[model samples]
Every structure is written in C-alpha cells, then in structure tokens.
Target: MVAPLSAWPWENLGNFKYLLCGPLAVKVFHSWNYEGTIEDHWCLHVLLICALRGLIHQLWSSYGNMLFLTRNRRIIQQGIDFKQIDGEWNWDNFIILQALLASMACLIFPSLNSLPLWNTKGFITLLLLHVAVSEPSYYWFHRFLHESNLFNHYHSLHHSSPVPHPFTAVHATFLEHLVLCIVIGIPMAGSITMGYGSTSMIYGYFAIFDFLRCLGHSNVEVVPHELFNKLPFLRYLLYTPTYHSLHHTQMGTNFCLFMPLFDAMGGTLNSNSWQMHKKISSDSGKNGRVPDFVFLAHVVDITSAMHVPFVFRSFSSVPFSTRIFILPLWPFTFLFMLVMWAWSKAFLLTFYNLRGYLHQTWVIPRFGFQYFLPFAMEGINKRIEDAILRADRIGVKVISLAALNKNEALNGGGTLFVEKHPNLKVRVVHGNTLTAAVILNEIPKDVEEVFLTGATSKLGRAIALHLCRRRVRVLMLTLSTERFQKIQREAPMDCQNYLVQVTKYQAAQNCKTWIVGKWITPRQQNWAPSGTHFHQFVVPPILAFRRDCTYGDLAAMRLPDDVEGLGSCEYTMERGVVHACHAGGVVHQLEGWTHHEVGAIDVDRIDLVWEAAMKHGLRPVSSG
Candidate 1:
C-alpha cells in the first residue's frame, strides 16, 4: 500500500536539496547589509540552528561507527548495508523544511522575531511543556503508527534498518517526519505564544531533541550501568541506546520518544531492556572477537582519505571519485591527513564477514607519496612490522600488506617481518602469487609473443617465468642485463630461450600483447601496434592514452557470492571486488595454509593459487 505522504517534493533533488534555502540566505544577507531589525534577521538564527543540527548528527555517526572505540559495546554487530545507506542519505532534509516553516512563522507572528537572547522562565516552561505535552503525544502517536496499516505504509521505512545508525534517527516517511515536527515544535511554540520565549530556549530545546534522538539510535551503548544503579529512577527518565534498540528489534515494546517513563506508564516497556543495557555496557576486551584476516592498507591520496565507511556512507559504498560536494571538506581533510602522517599509527578502517569469519581493514598512517621518500622507508617498515606483531599477539590468522605496504625496496614484500619475528603465529602475506595468476590468466591462450615492462621486478619475473613454461615468447624490457639474466636463468632450460631481453620500447613495435609491470609514458605506449591491449600490475594505473587499445584494471577478483556484511568498496574497485593481493590473503585464510605467503612469489604455485581461488568461488575480474 502506497502512503499519500510517502514521497517528498524535493526527494528527487539529491544534493541539490540544499538549494531550497537559497531564498532565505539571500533575504538574510540583504537584511544584514541594510542593518535591519533582529526580526528581519530571524531567518539567520533558523539557518544556523539547522547547520548545527546537521553537524551534531554527522559527529554522532562518525563516532558511532568508529569500531575501534565502540565495537565491543555496539548493540548491532552487523555492518550497515547499502540499501539503508541510500535510504538515509538525505536524513537532514527535514532540517531545511523545519527552517522554512520557522521562517514563515516569524513573518506571521511579530513577537517571535523580537525574543530576548535568554530567559530563565521560558527555559523552565519549555521543559515542563515537553514533559506534560510532547512526551505523551509522541508515545501515543508512535503506538498509532505501529498499527498494521500505518506501519506497512509509512513507519516500516524507518524500521527497515536492522541496525540503527545515528542518521537512522531521522529516516522516516514525509508524514512521519511532519508529525515529528509538530511533536517537537509544541513546547517551543507554547513558550513563544505564552510571551516567555527567548532565542536560547528555542536553540537549546532543538539541540537537546536532536542530541537525544541521535543518542537513542547510535547503536553503541555509552550509558554507564553504574549511574542507573546509583540513581535507581534515572532509567525511567532517560532512555539508553539499548532501550531504543529493543524497539527496533522487538517492535511491540518501548515506544517512548526519549524517556522510558511514558513506556512504563503505557505498559509497553520491554522486560529485557535493563538486562540488555547492563550486558552491553559491561562488555570489555576479552569478549571481543579477533579478526581472521587483516588487510593493512594506507591512504592513496587526499581524495581517497574520505572514502572510509564512516565519512560518507553513500559515497564509500561505490567506487570513489572526487565530487563537487566533497570539495568543501578538502581543507579539514587535508589537516587530518597531516596529523595522521605525523602522529598516528595503524588504525581500523572498516570490516565485514566472509563465510562466518571476521575480516577487517586497517590503515597505515602514512600516505602513498611517503613510501618513495628515502627517509620515510624506515618509518613505514616499522609501522608494518608493529602491525604484524600486534596481529600475532591477538591470534589473527593472516595479515596482508596492501599496495605500497609490501614495496620491495621498503620491506622486501613483507619478508623482513617474517624473518625478524620467526616465532610469530600470524601468517604475513604480500599476496602476489594470486596477483601473478590473475594477470597471466588475462592473456589469450593463442598469443605467442608479448612485450613485458618492469621485466625484472617481482611480479614481472613471475609472469615471465610462468608464460615461458607455456612456450610463449616474452620480450623482457630492462636496461640491466644482469637482472634480466637472473630472472631468465630461473626459467627451465628449454623455456629459457622463450625469455628474450630488450632495452628499448621500439623492440616491441611488432608485438600486439603488452604486459606492463611499470609505468609507461605515452611515447612508450605508442610503440605498440594499433590494437595492443595493455595488461598492467602497475600502481596508480597507467593512463589510457590510446582509445584504439583497451587497458586492463589492476588485477582484482570478485568476492564469493556467499560473502556477507560487505558494505564498503576497496579503493577504486567496484563493490564486492578487491585487489588480487587482498583476495590472495583471503584464500590463504580460507584454505588454512600454515606458510606465510611473503617475499618472492613461487612461480610453481601460480596455477595452484588460481585453482584454490576458483574452488572457493573467487572469480577473476574481467580485464575489459
């Protein structure tokens, strides 16, 4: 059944919904420019209050989803899915609507515009009115909405989230929010019409209302159990997060707005609310689950820094790209980046479940540019080593070094950690074995000769060695003959002839297949024939200079269909797809391999890793 109030007029506006305030903004600026009375400046206060409300909600969300602080006490252990994210993306829309309504009220009522900054009597009146009127009204109206017809048509939209985030507080149908506006506005309206209202009373009441709503739905229990035990009656007066969580989980009970006193009075309080609150609040370190696998990665750039799950849920759910709205946040994010570079250590970013095992992603405090700095190498490797040791101490099954975390020049592809700490129980993996397999499998079976760049690097060596075994000719590009001969000698006696050294890009002019493990300029890419597809394992993938030739993405794999609770994308890869190395670490944990898959990749296991990944439902991402 479609509800009459299910759709909003600005629902289709997306980020453009902010433009609805444009007229008020212009009016406020014009009034200020002309030195108009406080009555003419009243819209400024409404707009300021709206902006503060939005900030409060955003802070609550970021703090709630920071698992490092709240994971143990979190009432809901599951990740927030994309559907809930999209539904709640515009949670602040009501703030703008309320601002407009307030503006209209100011124009109609001359007294509301000339209110004093503070009034002790008005503040007391607001509190009493909230208790006598707003509380009871909301308790019964909420119960009415829960009735079958109303719940199905409108209220179900809010209850659809199995896990309640801070934004979930405002996630409701237009009718539901319109009712909420009245319930909230009554006390402030009563104080104003009674001639006792002030600027602070309106601002103070709205702030408290927004704060309490966010607190109830935060899903992280922060109310100390001792406080309730000491006071005994505070539980009825102040509803904890656990109390509201029960309403979402067991919908028939605990239907009060912010206080459980109304629920007790209505005989709708859940019997288990107090018990659940105490349990979640008392939980600590020993009760937490250690992750099965940890993918240790670092921020790639300034834009990628905002791609964490808590920053912007909708943006983080899909592949990352710089958007116009994100530009406003650049200054703050840049300062955060500098602080992380100077003082931060490895920290948890986000997590998901894979076949009942917990997998988490952790961020190294350094950025991609710092890895190439001569002085920063020691610092970067120290961070990786410390992370590996910490994972071993915590019983983590496998820890994978991502991107530049495994750079050979920096840490020898995670070998330094394994060698330095030989007694460690956790398996350290660079995950390049499967990376090689993914790149090799992309080539057509009939292709005879291919041009290879970065031919002597780790992946380049493995790819060349594997292809030569299939009797495919490889024109290995490198200026150093010694490094080329070293990789060539590793190949079998008969296949050694299949590996040929070339010092220049022009040598590959006739070759139609190009395998690039290193960056290539447009001048170098132009050497390939018209239809030569570029298959690369390069970081910050090479530019697509030629429209005539296709460019392959960095080797990646789609997670198994059964993967659960995956809510965020991995860097630029689409949802459910991850870099090949990250997938390799997952394969290691799934297969229960005892050996650490670090250092140089074993060319012999290229096919073995591929088969194991396939057996476990990991599909190679299409190069196209």
Candidate 2:
C-alpha cells in the first residue's frame, strides 16, 4: 500500500508551520526597509502574494460554513466529521511553501528580481500560457493521479472530503502540491522569462487562481443558471461548485481543475452536472426543507463567539477552550457582539440528523453576560419569542430553549411564550425535565441523604420532590424559607419530611453527596467532607477545588450511535455528547410528545422522561 507521495516535512509543526517562512519574511522586510523602492523586490512581493492567498482561503472558509446564509444552497447534504476537519487544519501550509520556493527562485534567477509593477503585455502572456499549457497539463496530470497506486496514495487525500469545503481545494499530499506549484509557476515563470512579466500580473493571476479554487470547493451553489443559459459556452469554460463536487464523489469524471472543457474533451463530463446545479441553486430559495427540531442556544462569552462551527471547524469539533490563535480574533468578535446586540436575530448554527429527523441548532444573537443585564431582558425575551413563532411557521415540531434563553427571571422558563401563543403548533420546551432526570440518575441508588444547593430553583425543586418520593433525605439549601416551604408543599404529605430546609453550607458537612445547582466557591466547597462527591448542573462548571472529592460534569447525554452528521461538540462537552436539556428536546421529538414542557419541571414525568430517553438510545454521560 506504500505510495509515491508522503507527508509534508512541516506537517507535525501544527500552528508553527507559518514559522517556516519566518527567515524569508525577515529578509524581505529588511530589504524593503533598506532599499528605496519595493517595485523590484521579488521576495517581498512573493510574501505579500502568499499572505493574500491564505487570506482568500480563510474568507471563503468562514463565509461558506455560515449555515444561516448557505445551508439550503449547500451542494452536499452530508456533514463533515472530525477526521476531515483534522486533515484540512493545515490547508494553508502550501501557501507558506510556495512563498519559500518563490524566494529561492528569486535568489537563483537575476531576471525574476527586476520585474515591473505593471505590464499589460506580461499579463496577456501569462493568460495565454495558463490557458495553452497549464490547463491541458493539469487536466491530464490530475487524471493520471487517479490511476491505481497514485490514487491510493496521493489523490485520495484530496478526495477524502465528500462534502468539499473551501480549504479542501489545497488539502493534499506534499508531492501532489509540489506538482501544483509547477502547474502555477509555468505561467509566471514563462511570462517573466519572456521579458513581459510585472508585479501586478502575478498578483492578479494568483488572486484569480485562489478565488476560483475557493469557489469550486465552497459547497454552495452560487453561479446562476441564466448566465450559463445566456452564454452556454461558459459551462465548459468555468466549473461551478456542483461541477467540482461530482469529481470528489464520483472520482472518474470531471478531471479538469478550474475548467470543465477538458472533462468534456476527455469524455468524462457527468451529464447531470448542469441539472444538479440548477436544482441545488433553486433549493437555496424559500422552498427549502424545514427541520423538525431546533435547539436555540446563545454564545456564553467573547471567546465562545468564535467556538461556533462556521468560525473554525477544527476548534469547534472538540471541546471548546480558549486558544492562542483565537486571542487575536477577540477584537473582531467583540465588535460582532455589539452589532448582534443592535441588529441581530436568531440564526442557524449547526445541524445533524437522528432517526430520519432533521435537528438544527439556532443561535440567539446575544452573549451570556447580556442575558444577566436587567435592561436587555425585554430585548432577549422578544428575540426568543420571535424565534419560537418563526419555528411554528416553518412547521418545526419541537423547539428547545437552551441555557439563558429559558431563564426563569426573564420569561418563566418559556412559559410566557406558550401562554401568549396558546394555540401554537410547535411545542416550546425548556428541557429542565430531562435536566433534572440526568442529574438525579447520576446519584447512586443506595444513597440515602444528599445536600442540594439552589434547592428552590426549577431543577432543584424537581430533584427534591422526586428523591423524597423514593424515601431519600433531601437537605435543601436556600435562604428563602417561603420558597422552600412552597416547593415542599407540592410533595405528598407523607414524603414532605424528607425535604429539609437548611440555610448554611455547614448543614452539608455530614453529607457525602452534594448536588450543586448554583456556583460554589472554594471556600464554600471546603465545608463538604473529604469524600463528598459534587454533582453539579451549573454553567461554566465550578472549578475542581477538592482533589479528593470527585466533581460531575454539567448534566449531559451521549447521543445514540446511530446519530449522523454530529461534527461539533456542544460547548465544553466532548464530541457526540450534548447538554441534557438538548437531549430532552430530542427525546421529546422521538417519543412524539405533544405537550409543551415549560415553566416547572414535572416531578411525575422525571422517571418517564428518563426511561423514554433510554428507550430511544440516549445514554447518560458519566459523572466525573
């Protein structure tokens, strides 16, 4: 199985691959600072050109993956997995290598060093060379790579992504990319050698090259049908996204790089290309398919704004954490937050399929801190209500409120929406019913007594009532005796004694099991006994203060193995695991439950929801 091509030498460097061009960049800058003019500086021009290439790729990646803008027009219905994301992480590595090579070429050749800033003649020569030599050569070379051994080693890497992303255009083996450098260089080298080369022409050509490359792999149908119909020859001259996508999926056909004329000449053109293009582009209209469930979520922090699927695919695929690269993007993200606060609406984030049903995540355009602002409450509630009503209009069967979207202080856990629109079809769910079930189930069945914090909140209240029914002692911690008595009154008279109201952390020192529904600092955590295990349903999970005492994650559930296209993790949760509330919504849709689960967590439905989740293959995440 050993093949001709191998990995790039800098492949192991990860983010440090950019460092490969450091020496050359320093040389170019030093020369530019000393020299009077940069018009004849080949190295500096090469560096700037390479930087533009990377920028172009990044712009397309971000724009193409924005689900709210491009979901319906997406050529591929399938989702990208973690493996594809990892492979494409260093897609811009080739640009760095190109810069290094071009610098070396400048050093080797005296003629390439003195190119002018503009040359109409050189631009024409470059275009002719690209059309006459580069086009046909790349066509056959690309076709040759599909041959047995070459395909197995070199070409398959590029074809690995079934749903082609913008970066997928350059995600290839080192040897394959080396050949690509030659294909691109022929035009530039040829124009310069003939004394017709210019700096502007080089910039112009590479920009077009990158733009076309990104366009082909963007996975969204952007080219209109009327243009091709009005000028039919453009079909063979220019390849669309649907055209390139067929090559990745079918492999044998559409061997041309940017032009499909070679495919037509080689008798490899798929007849269905234009028809498929029309269908996909038309589908991007208002008649597109509607999802069955939508999980409405909001950004948690400034860093979290970039932890979305569209921002950076690889970063979003795993558990979200602040990274060094993301630090540089903070200012841009902060500005975006301000814009969202002023003019944003609920937008699509990501989506996946489960049991033939479409489920999507929609983002509320506000940060977590904004939800805590008293002045923003009305605006936040209006956004949530608008999203709910929109989902109802779209025929969504279930729409789940996530985190602060369902805050009791603002909208009574989605009760206000349901009450206002009593006849709405889409079931509005706060999902705390299953949130309580997940936290309660994490407790060992044999445990008799447990300390509970935020004991009067919706989830805490449900847990207290459910545990008391099982003859377990519930040490409810809250300062409001009136709220505690109100919750306790709901329990049966015989089981009311089990729900004890304790006002201090000292009351829990004797208890080995702690259910944390609110944030607890290290000082408060010290009150727990040495072996006390903390089970929390808190956001931004409390720090692990007690090394001796284990702490459980925020209640989450591992999706069923049958779940498809689940590429990104939910916040800090690991891949394939989502918060228990999101799982609750899925379970609601699967069980065909018509009732809206809002306001209070129904104590009676705790076991019923848990069993239904288990029946449908949703398993509780381990408490650690």
Tens digit per residue, CA lDDT, model 1, 1-624: 566988777988887988888888888888777766433668788889998899889989989877767888888888886667877878887898898888888888877778999999999999999999999999999999999998989999999888999899998888988898899899999998888999999888988999999999999899998899999899999999999999999999999999899999999999999999988888844448899999999988778899887787778899988888888888988998788767557888888888999999989978789999999899888888888888988899999989799999998998888888899899998999999999999999999999999899999999999999999999999999999999988999999999999999999999999999999999889999999999999998999999889999999999998887787889889889999999999999999999998888999999999999999999999665
| Best-fitting candidate, scored by lDDT | 1
Model 1 has an lDDT value of 0.90
lDDT of each: 0.90, 0.89
Write model 2 residue lDDT over 1-624, tens digit each, in one string.
445456888867877888888876777667678875554467667778987998888889888878888887888887776778877878887898788888788878877776788999998899889989999999999989999978888888888876798889999898988999999999998999899998788899999999999999999889988889899999999999999999888888988978899889899999999998887877678546789999999989899889987788778998998889899999999997788767668988889999999999999988888899999999899999999999999999999999899999999999999999999999999889999999989899999999999899889999999999999999999999999999999999999999999999999998999999999999999999999999998887899988889999899999999888788989989999999999999999999999999998888999999999999999999665
Position 98, candidate 1: lDDT: 90
Top candidate when judged by TM-score against the true structure? 1
